[model samples]
Target: MIWSSASAGPTNTLLPAGGCTLLPRATMYAPRMLAAVAQESQQRCRFCTRARAPRSQSAGWREVRRSISSNASPAWHHTRSISTSHLPRAPLAPAEIAPSKRVIFSGIQPTGVPQLGNYLGALQNWVKLQDSQRAQDEMYLSIVGLHALTVPQKAAQLRQEKWDMLAAILAIGIHPDKTVVFFQEDMPQHLELAWILACCTSMGKLNRMTTWKGKLAALQSASESGEATITSSEASSLNLGLFSYPVLQAADILLYKATHVPVGEDQVQHLELARDLAETFNRHHATGQRYFAPPAHLITPTKRVLSLRDATQKMSKSSTDINSRILLTDEPEAIRKKLKGAVTDSERRISFDPEARRGVSNLLRICAALDESRDAHGWAELVNERGGGSGMLKSVTGDVVLAKLEGVQKEIKRIKGDKAYLEKVARDGAARARERAERTMREVREMVGF
Candidate 1:
């Protein structure tokens, strides 16, 4: 889950690494006091479970609550609900569409690899959600090529990147059949819905968004010299597409009428924006009749996996240093080399102190995330078993990362080899998405008298 940098709290307590549990969605954000806050000021705030949007009648909220009560609760696993939404679009049967089995929507930009943070923070959670799932309640995972264009790109290179990322995601076990997988740019309706939602959105709201602020910060930092200072004018040199991108994101959610959005904590603000827009539009056009229900955040509970070489920074595609990040397609040898070369504190002890030993602690965090059993206890034992040294922790963590990545690499190779099949899948998935998006957009347009 992504939130304010200062606001991030312990995503999981290491009980043992052997087998961590799939926590109930609610528990992900249960008030665990943070040492990061002043001792006297410490308050119980939902850490990892932060959502970008709000909806009182959100189907995702009910599903997530029920998910926790059932999966982690031995007493209530068998209970079922019939109907949760008063909206016309609400899912009909709640019993069969249990949280574990409910439809889910998550997408990523095909802007090459997002570094270790993306993999550990979001992708791993995707695997868990996909694997633990029971029935085939709809799951659509998109490689959003369209989202990529807010920045510049080469057409040929971008196309190849799109295909490559799809294979990579697939290799990571996103079964195209079990989940509807597609390229977002392939659908005309994504843009269509984006336009409809944009009408409801204000320029003022878009201007206040943080995405452009981040870009501006990155630009300023890169250009900073001992004597140079950047101005807001320099920042505003960037254009509208980047600023208004969230409107498109809102459209993505509304187009799917996605009850649940599997979002990292960072995206909660954006999701909240989406919710606000959805509610505003729904209310504005209700004509004393309700339309779309608000979307709910399916907060993912994976640690914000940091850089292997730099604990201070999140692993990112933008990192200038080669060793700072790990790609999903990294070969076992490359993974080993990267881990072996990782930055660790001079201290010998292997512990989870993010404050004192950022580097070593970062490795430990990654190990915990990739822990085969997802058990913190098993991970702790493994760390202790590695002789309680930083080197051993790095070694063990490297092994675990390699092991987890092995299948992903193999699947990527296989999928990449079949370009024709991949294109066919993308085409089919796009068609389906466009159909749904168009349906929603048409309704939205009529509601707005467009």
Candidate 2:
């Protein structure tokens, strides 16, 4: 029998014998070659008869003896020529193989203009991920307009916000070529896959989720405070899209077969839901074949920017007061005015205490974000040594914030003015995203018996 040796594993060794060679591997098929030889060989002369024919029996006998010494098994021992073509080729060792490409997908809503919190917490890190990723890996940053539609929006203003957000993303140095920056509503596959995932999702799990509850609670608070007209009983008026958007978020991650999803602490639960849905689909449809990759969360470093007005709460777009949050596109005058009016404790000392002195702590945190070299505690110490009160604290914070946002504002203005460039970026990003999504969908359809 012909023995193909390339299929041997690294741990496998060749066993040398008087008349044959044996390969030892994890799962060796076809019993020991010697055993096969003893069972198949009718007589000792058979080995001699299969040897290369010589002019005389004396020369032929010598050839058989040489063949046996060299451990060359004859191909016609059982009246059939053994072909090595059927042997399975072994794959390369792990160290010799190329590393698999990592697919990263993350998105943000264009609910309103992105603020300082959005930049430091999410957008800035996105550019870092894109710049540091290897060529084989892909990073996607989407403008999720669909998610924004969970609530009401004016058509003209929504369109403007989408373009404005895109310009802001570009201004922050996220390369369009390296990172896919598309509008989520532009891709129909996202919704298509969302419906499929929703079918597999459990109602109990959805009920257990707290995001919807938190949103309603915020709405109720707004109503009580006269910031909104909706009453507590009007919670039922909330749209189905708002309640079930988590499933769509899952679809977004799975559609691109993303391996990593960068999210904040608040969004970790949503990423977990995405992971569960992906695993559920794979279990039901793909079985042993994992067509969907359960994505992992690349949680952003915790950097919570509190409201300028009330440091107890986070900076949010829903806040009716524009000064509560600093917008990325805010002019120097506006930034100076907002920071000047920011609340601080009555204490003469500059200190960082979230529980006791929230407003002061918020300013310190903002300063820390703008200047990474100094943390909040370090800044607090520096301000204390300088004998600065709230005025000194506000001045220092405003100067740092303005210095950092100046280039960003200029870049955003330049990018927003280029309408054709913005359109091209959106179109190109959508095409690339669609290409990746279609590939995953095709495999999913086949596995689901579509």
Candidate 3:
């Protein structure tokens, strides 16, 4: 959760990350605490207004306690009495809507620096969609800090990572005005709504999920490979946070009532689970109306980006080897260095057969993704016709990749330097995101009897 500078006690004083202070006991909230602090905080500091904006609501402890006891609790309890007429009409089913009318929501975890796979696979597509979408199409870009907590992290590093992720997003051309880009931690509604959906979800469905199983397998493989020091017993002790992360993921989408989610092939299962939960929720609480849209997948063409070091696996930040993935922040020289060392087969001719030649195909895909004019197949054919082998392909790929990312890298540096601008973007984006989320949540409270 995003921290606040206004500390109630020594225990409450959270370390700063990005520009904001992390709140104390931020992740843990009993119903009483939810009613007391979260509600009060949102109401008081609703927006990070411009320099000329009026005074914000007081964050004083007594004020919060008094407000909770008087207004917040009663208001919450009053949801039971909310008339059906007070609620807005639910939109048409997924099949009935056009792309323009749909709300698109997607997120990336702020766990670490995003790599080349992250840029090409997800972030780049996000910007393209935003720019091309109809004015009616609403989009949200989330720096999902909560999801990062599923794995362990140092608080200081996580905070810094959170800011760094946002900067990368902005640098890559995600405008706050065109899209809502915010920290997932800022909104308590995500967790609150997750609990409600969790009740409707089955443990069996969660068990069948491939994501947790994949994590387990990866950890087991790491243990065997000596890449990570995790033991079998340690793997067995995987926390509930990691296990039930899909529920939180579901909440991230459903909270925004997102109609479309742009995802890679690996994430298709999670998206499907989101649809199931929405259907189940509608059946139980929606009362013949589907309150949450069953989010459809807006699968991109170049979805699966493999690791530079290991073409067999998707590129990842978890790998101990830095060369496994090309980070968005890498300098041009670093990019050249990594690409020069990228693994490829001995076959002199660069071909696009992924099954027989994954490394060459991966490089071809990277070049293809960077240059929108040519598809992967077309690029592969061109490279083969040019009589250039893997060496030539790697050199060309490096140049094209470096050229594409030049502006983004520069912008990232600038954004990092301007701490105030970073804070403003986060604050403003959080304000806008919370506004939309609260609307959905109010209906949720009414339907679920609070």
- Top candidate, metric TM-score: 2
Error of 2 at 352 (Å): 2.1
> Would you estimate the TM-scores of all the predictions?
0.73, 0.75, 0.74
| lDDT tens per residue, model 1, 1-450 | 122101111122222222212223223233223122112321222433333222232222211233223345431111111111222322111121223335577888885644567777777778777786667466778887767776667999887777887777777767766777888877777788788778878888876777766876777676775456556665555867778888888877777766667776567778767766766665556442225445566655767767777878788776788788888877778878888888886565556777877887777777777765645445656777656776787788888888877777777788899989888888888777677677877887787777
Q: How far in Å is the alpha carbon of 261 misplaced in model 3?
A: 1.1
Looking at model 3, how many pairs of residues clash?
3
Q: What ranges in model 3 sit over 4 Å off?
A: 1-100, 215-233, 377-387
TM-score of 1: 0.73
lDDT of 3 by residue, 1-450 (tens): 110000011111121222222222211111123323343233322222222111143232221222434443332211111122223322222232243476788888885557888887778878888898787878888888888777678999999988998898889999999999999999999999999989988898888888778777878798789877986556655889877888888899889978777766666677767767876777678753446656666645555678889999888888888888899888888888898888897777667888988888899888888887887788777777778687788888887898898898899999899999999999999999999999999999999997
lDDT tens readout by residue for model 2, 1-450: 000001112121122222322222212222112222122222343423433222242221211111243475533322121222134423321122122777788888885558988887777788878887997988887899898877777999999998998999999899898899999999999998999999999887776668777877878798789978875446654778878888998898889877777777666677767766865776567652345655666644656788899787788788899999899988889998999889897787888887888899999988998898899998888788778789888888988899898898899999999999999999999999999888888887888789
Off by over 4 Å in 1: 1-102, 113-115, 131-136, 215-226, 229-237, 373-386
* Candidate 3 similarity to native, TM-score: 0.74
CA lDDT, every prediction?
A: 0.64, 0.72, 0.71
TM-score of model number 2: 0.75
**Candidate 2 weakest ten by summed lDDT:** 1-10
Q: How many backbone clashes does candidate 1 have?
A: 20
